[model samples]
Target chain A: MSKALLYDATLCIDCKQCEAACADQNKLPYDDNIAKEERQSEHKFTAVLSKNDKYMRRLCMNCQEPACVSVCPVAALRKTSEGPVIYEANRCMGCRYCMAACPFGVPKYEWSSLNPKVRKCTMCPDRVLAGRQTACAENCPTGATKFGDRDELINEARKRIQDNPANYIHHIYGVEEVGGTSVLLLSGVPFEEFGYRTDFPRDPLPLRTYQVLSKIPDFIPLGFVTLGGIWWITHRREAVAAAEGRQAHQAGKELK
Target chain B: MKIKFTFWKAVFLLIVAAGAYGTFVRFFRGLGASTNLSDQFPWGIWIGFDVLCGVMLAAGGFTLTAAVHILNIQRLKPIVRPTILTAFLGYVLVSVALLFDLGRPYNIWHPLIMRNPHSVMFEVAYCVMLYTTVLALEFSPIVLERFNLQKPLKVVKAVLIPLVLLGVILSTLHQSSLGTLYLIMPTKLHPFWYTPLLPVFFFLSAIAVGLAMTIFESSMSSKHFGRELELPILQELGRVLLVVLTVYAILRFEDLLHRGVFHQLLVAGYERNLFLLEIVLALVLPLTLLAIPKIRQSAGGLYLAAVSVVLGFITNRLNVSITGMETAAGLHYVPKWTEIAITGAIIAVGFALFALAVNYLPIFPEHREAAGPEAPVAAKAAVLSHAGD
Candidate 1:
C-alpha cells in the first residue's frame, strides 16, 4: 500500500545539490570524513550515488511485505497504511537480523555508536500521510528519482522505454526484481552493469528461511532415549519394589 | 542440599555472570557489540556451534536411554539419568545461545503470540520451547523420586511414553530444520555443504554424533565415578556410529555429485581444508578405529575415536553455517570475545551439571562383569539388565 521511488542513474547529474538539501533538511553534517567516521550520517530519502561516470540515486523501493518488516522478529519495522517502510528506533533492540535478512541490503547499521539505528530510505511516510509530495521528487533537478503510485510509475517506465529504445533498456529494474519493488527504473544499459541485482527473487526471503527450518526432524531419533530412559527408570522402580516384597516374604516365613 | 561450595558450582556462577553480561550488553547496545555476527555471516558460532552441532552432541542422552530402556538392556540404566541431565542442560544452553543472536530479546514472545507458520524460525522457537518443557518434565521424576514423592513419580511414569514420543516428534522437526535452514542459501553455502538433501545429511550426522557422545561421555564419566562400564554395548554403539558415519560420508560426496559441486570441495581454500578435516576426524578416523575389534576393545582407543567423531561433527556444522555461507558481500568472520566467552561458559555449565548429577543422583551402574574383549549378545543383554534396578 506504500509508494516507492525509482531512480535511473543515467539521468542523475551528481551536482551535490540533492545531498546538500538532504543534509540541511535532515540535520546531517556536510560531506566530511569526520561525520562519516562518527557513524551518525543521516540517510536522505534519496541519495545521489557518487563516484561513477553516471550518477546513481539510492533509495528504498518500499517493497510489499518488505523483508525487514517480515524478519523483524518483533514489529519494530512496519509498513504504514500509505505504503512506506518506517522504523521505530526506541522499540528496536538494535538486533540487525533485519539487515541480514534483507536481500537488497537496504538497512544499514550504525555500527560505531553505542546506540545505533538502522539507516535506510523511508518513503517520507510522515509527509505522504499529510498529503504532500516527497522532498526528493520535488528537488530532483533531472526528474531522475520519481514519486508516484507504483502502477502509474510502471506505465511511465514502459512508455519511456518504448519512446526511446536507444536510451532505455526494455526492462524496468525493480518492477520484477524481487517480486516487483514499488520503484521502477528505465535505463540504457543492463541492470547488472548498474550495480543492481536484476535476477533477484520475487519470493520474500522469510519463506526461504522457513523452507529450510521445516526439515529439522534430524534430531528426533536421538529423542527416542528420553522416553526409553523413563521406561528404564520405571522398570528399575519395579525391580526395587519386587526386591522389597521378597524381603517381607522371608520375614513372614521366619515368623511362621 | 546446602553444603560447602563445590568446584562445579563456582564454574556455574561464572557462566551465569558471563551469560548475564552478554545479555545486558545486547540489550543496551546491539548484536554488533556482542558478537562477530555480520551481514556476510549472520549466523556465527551461536548458530553453527550451539544450535546446529551442540544439539547433535547432546544426542547421546537419548541414544543411551533408548538402548537401555526401550531395548530392555538394563546394563545401560546407570548412565541414563546423567545422560538425560546432560541433554536437558544442553537444550537449555542452546535456548540461551539463541537469545544472543536475536535482535530483540524482549520481543521473543511475539513469535509465540503471533504464529508465523511459514517462518523457519517459528518452528525452531516452538520446538525449542516444547522440547525444553518436555525435557524438564522427563527429568522431573528423578528429582521427585529422590524426594520420596511417590504420587508425583507415579503420575510421571504413566505419561512417560507419550511425552517421550512427543519429544521425538519435535526433535525430528527441529534437528532436520537446522540443516534445512541452510537449504535456501544454495548460493551462499559451499558445494561441499549444500544440497536439497541437506535435511537428510543433518539427520544422519546427528545420529552418529549422538552415539559417539554416549561413548565418550560414558567413558569420561567412569573416570570420575569409578563405576564399571559396560564396554561391549558401547563397542556395539560405536559400530552403529560407524554405519551412520559411513552412510553420511557417502552421501556427503553423493550430494556434491548430484549438485555438480564436487569440484568445489577441492578448490584450495579454508573451506576445503575445514571440510576435509571434518571427514578425517569425524568419519575416517573413528571408522577405521572401530572396525577392527583389536582397536575397538580398548577403552582408550574407542574413547579417543568418539571424541574425534564429536569434534568432527562440530566442524561439519561450522562448515555448514560459517565456513560455507556466502554473505551479501564481505570477508570471513571471527566471533567477538563476548560471544566466545558466552559459548565457553555454556559448555562449562553442561559439565558442571553432569558432574553434580553423577555425584549425587544414581548415574553410574553399581557393578558389572569385566569384558575379556568379546561379548556375545546374550551376555551383553544380561550385563545390561543387571546394571541398575
Candidate 2:
C-alpha cells in the first residue's frame, strides 16, 4: 500500500492555513535572514500559487522514483521505509545536483543560510509515524489536500472525475507523469495550462537522464583506438629516424 | 620580452583581498547575498563559468595527449604537459566552486563514504575524485623532473602511457557525465537546450573546445613566454579546430531540427538574440576563419578563433544551466555582491595556483624541447645504465 496525498487546487481557497499549520507543526522560522529584497516568494513546503484566475498548491509530488533522491550525490535524501522521499540536511553536501535534477523543479535551497539545506515538503513523515495526520491534510478547511494510501486516493479521485465530467478535467495529474507520482492532483483546467508538467515519458527519471550517458561507452574505445593508431605511426617514424641517424654517425666516425 | 609578473602579483593580491571580503559576506549573509541565483535560477555564473567552461578549457590535456602519446604525434608533445597542468588547475577550480555551492560543505565526505550506487551524482562524485587522482598522477612527472629526481621520474615515465589513456577515458566519461547530470531535470531544462542528444553535444563541443583552448592557451603561452611559437604545430591545430566547429555547427542545427526547436530560434527575443550571437561568434565565425587554409596557418588569426570558440562554449553553458532554465516559482535570483566576490575568489585562486606551478614547476616547455628536444643525455645516463645492468 503506497502512501500518497491528493491535492485538489479547485478546493483550495488560498487561506494559507496549510502553510501556517506546516510552519507551526515543523517549528520553522519566518527566515528573517531572507531580507525583504531577498524574499521574492513565500517560503514553505506547500505553497499556494495564484495567477490568471487560478490557484495551485505547490508541494512535493513524490514521484515513483523521485528525481531528488536519485540525483542526490550523497544519500542525504532518501525514500523512507514507508514511502516518503526525505532529506537529512546533516548529510547533504549541498552540491545542488538534486535541485538541478528534479523534473518538477520542486527542491528549494536554503540560500539564506551560511550552511543551506534543500527544502521541500516531506509529507509530514514524523506525524505519520506517530499515527497522526499531516499538517496540510489535518488543517485544510476545504479538504483540498487529503492523505491516505495511494491506490485508495487514486480510485477516489477517479470516481469523482467520473461523476462530474464538466466539473473536472478527465486526466489525473501525476497518475503517469514522469512514471507516476505518489502525490496526485485533481483540477478543473488542464494540468499543462496551469504550468503542470504532463508531457513526461514513462521511463524512470534516471533512465531519461542516461539519454546522454549511455553513448559514452562507444566513444571511450573509439577515442583511444584512434589515439593508439596515431601513437604507433609516430613512434614507428621516430624509431626509423633514430636508427638512420645512428648509422650515419657510425659511418662518419669510421671515416675520421 | 619576458614581462616579469610582479604586475600579476599585485593584481593577485588585490583580487585575494576582495575575494576574502566577499566570502565573509556570503558566509554571514547566505548564497542569495552572494549570487544572482534563485529557485528559478539555482545555477548561475558560478556553475556556468566555473564548471562548464573550466572543464572544456581543460580538454586540452585529453585532446593533446591523444595526439601525442596516444596517436604518437610527437609534434604535439610541447603542448601536452602544459595543457595537463592547466587542466589540473581547472578541475581544482571546479572542485572549489562545488564546495562553495554546497549547502553543507562539512558533510561532503558523507557521500564519499556512504556509497550510494543508485545515484547519478554518486557516480559523479566518485568520478571527480578518481579523475582528480588520475590528473595528479598524470602531472607528477613535472614535479619530479624539476627536482632532477631521475629515479622517480623514470618510474613515472613508465606509467605515463597507461596513465595518459586512463586520463582520456576518464575525461570522456566525466565530460559527458556532466551533461547527464542534467538528465533528471528534463522539464526544468529548456527544450531548446535540453535534447536527448545533450551528452553527445557536450562530448562533441568538449572535443572542439578542448582543441580550441589548447590552441588558445598554447598561443598565449608562446606570446608571453618568449618560446619560439610552434606555428606549424598550431597550423595543424587550426585545421582540427575547423573540422570540430564544422561538425558542432551541423549537429547543433540538427539537434534543433530534431527537437523542432528551430522555430524557437526565430522567437524574436533575447534568447533568440543570444542564440544568433552564439551561432555567429562561437561557431560560424571560428569555422569560417579556420576553414581558409592560409588564415589557419597564421598564428594570430588561429588564436582568435580559439578564443571565440571558448566564448561560444561559455555562452552555451550559461544558456543551458541558467538563462534558459526556468525553475523555481515567483523566484528569480540575482547574484549577490558576495556571489561575485566568491566567484572572483575561485578565479583568483586558479590564477594564483597557475602562477605558483609555472614558477616552481616546469609547466612551460623550454625552447629547445619543441625543436625536437629530448631529455638531457647526462640526466638519462644513470637511468640508461641502470636499465643495462
Candidate 3:
C-alpha cells in the first residue's frame, strides 16, 4: 500500500512535538532558533507555521509525479513506490535543478558545506519500509498528523469533510494539485491564506518539459537532412561553376 | 611575444587576481559564503550571465560556419576564424563559471554517466559537453596550421563539413533547450516571458545576437588591432540584423498578445518597466538604427547598433532567469561582490585570451582587400583549402 500523511490544520496545537520528532528521527540538530523558524531549511526538514490562529505544518509534498525527480540531471532525486521522494546524496552533482524545479520549494541546499547535499523531508523511508509509522505521525500528541494508506486517508478526509462541511473547506489540497501528492492537507481557511500556492496546474509539472523534449528525436534527423541537403546543393553548384570556368579557359587558350 | 604592462592590462590582472581569491573562498567556504543565492533564488548571475548569456553570445560559431560552409556565402569567410575562436573561448569560460556556481563542481561529469533524458537540464548538459568538443575540433585547424602539422590537418579538413553540421545541430538543440529549462516552471515564471514558444524565442534571439556579436567583434578588432574594417560585409550583416530583429519583435509581441498577457504590460510595475527597457535596448534601438541605410553603412553606427543588441540580449536573458521569477519568489536577489568579481574575472580572462590568440595565431585573413575590385585570391585560397575537402 502507498503510504501518506494527512495533516489537519485545525487539530494542530502548535506544540511542535512533531517538529522535534522529525529532527530527532532525521538526526538533525535542533535548538530554540530552529524551533522558532517558520520556514523549512537544510537543518529543518519540516516547520509548523502559525497563521490566522491556526498551525499549519510545512514539509515535502512527495508528489506522485515529482518535478524534482524529473528535473534531476543525474537521478539524484527519485520518487519511491512507498510514497516518498528520496534523495541519493552520492548521486547528486549539486546542480540544484531540483531546488529550482520543486513547485512547493521543499528542497533546501546545505550551501555552507564544502560538499553540500540537498535536504528535504524523506517521509521516514526507512521506517515506512520497515512497516512502521513516520516519526512525526508517531509522536503527534493530538493525532493532527496521521500516517496510513493513501487511499484510506483520502476516504477518511472526505468523511470528515462530508460529516462537517462548515468546519472545513470544500477542497482537499493535495488530491489534484500537481497531479496529486502523497501528503494531503485539510484546512478550515483557504490554503492561499497560509502562503500555499493555490495556482498550481492540475497536471504534473514535468509534462511541460517532456512536451518539448519528446520532439528532439524527430528534430535531430530533420536538422541533419536539411543541413546536409543545403551543403550538397551549394557545394555541387560551386564545383560545377569551377569546372565550367576551367573548360572556358581551355577553349580560350585553343583560340589564341 | 612580448607582454605589455599597460594600465588596462594592470586592471585586467587585478580583476583576475580578485576572481582567483573569490574562487578560493567559494571552494573552501562553500556557495553560501561566496554568493547571495538562497533557497528562494538558487540561481544568480553565474547561471544567468556566465552560463546563459555566455552560451547565447557564443552562437556566432555555428551561425558563421553554417553561412560560409553550408550556404556558400564566401564573403563572410574572413571573420569565421575569429568568431570560432570567440565561441571556443566563450564555452570554455562558461564551463569555468559553472565550476564556481555548481555546489559540487567536481561531480560535473555525473550528467554524462548518469543519464536522464527526460530532464531538459540533462539534454542541456549533454549538448554543452558535446558542442564544446565540436568547437574545439572546429578551432583545431588554426592551431594545426600554426604548428605546420600537415597530416592531421588533412584529416581534420576532410571531416570539416560533418563537424560543422554537427556543431549546428548541437547548437540548435542546446540554444533552444536553454529556454526549455524554464518550461517546467510555468507557475514560478511570469506569464509575460513564459509561453510554449519559449524555445522559438530563445533560438531566434540567439541568431540575432550571434550576428550582432560578429559585427561587434569585427569593429572591436579593427579599432584595436589597426586592421581595415570589412565594411561591405558588415553593412550586409546590418541589413540581415534588421530583418531578424523585426521578426523577433513581431513574434514576441504576438506571443504576449496570444497568451493574453499583453495587458500586464499596461500594469505599472518593475517587471513591465524592465520589459519595456529590454524591448527598447534589444529590439527597438537596433531595428531603428539598422533600418537606416546611412547608419548601416557607417562603421560607427553599425558598432553602436550591434552593442545595443548585445546589451539587450544580456538584459533579456537576465530578465528571464532572474526578474521574471523575483515576484513569485517573494524576495529580491542581488549578487554579492564575490559573485561580481568572479564574473568580471571570467570576462577579463576571455579578453586576455582573445588578445593572446589574435597576437599569436592567424585569426584574421592575411590579404587586405577592403571590398576592392581585385579578387582576394590568397584569402579565398586559405578558406577553399578547407572547404574543398
Best by TM-score: 3
B-chain TM-score of model 2: 0.88
| Ten-residue region with minimum lDDT total, candidate 3 chain B | B380-389
Candidate 3: DockQ? 0.84
TM-score for each predicted model, relative to the true structure: 0.79, 0.86, 0.95
By DockQ rank, best first, the candidates go 3, 2, 1
Which model is ahead, 1 or 2, in terms of TM-score?
2
Q: TM-score of A-chain in each prediction? A: 0.75, 0.76, 0.94
Q: Please say which candidate is ahead in TM-score: 2 or 3.
A: 3
Write down the TM-score for model 1. 0.79
DockQ of every candidate structure? 0.22, 0.53, 0.84
Kindly report which residue stretches of model 2 are placed more than 4 angstroms away from their true locations once superposed: A9-17, A29-43, A48-56, A129-133, A189-203, A211-256, B1-9, B326-334, B367-389
Candidate 1 ranges beyond 4 A from true positions:
A15-47, A69-72, A75-83, A86-95, A110-119, A126-135, A188-195, A198-204, A207-256, B1-32, B38-42, B62-76, B184-187, B293-298, B326-328, B367-389
Distance from true location, Cα of B277 in model 2, Å: 1.4
Cα lDDT of model 3 by residue, B156-228, tens digit: 9999999999999999999999999999888888887889899988999999999999999898777666679
- Give the share of true interchain contacts found in each model: 0.23, 0.77, 0.84
- Residue A87 alpha-carbon offset, candidate 2, angstroms: 1.0
The TM-score of predicted model 3 comes to 0.95
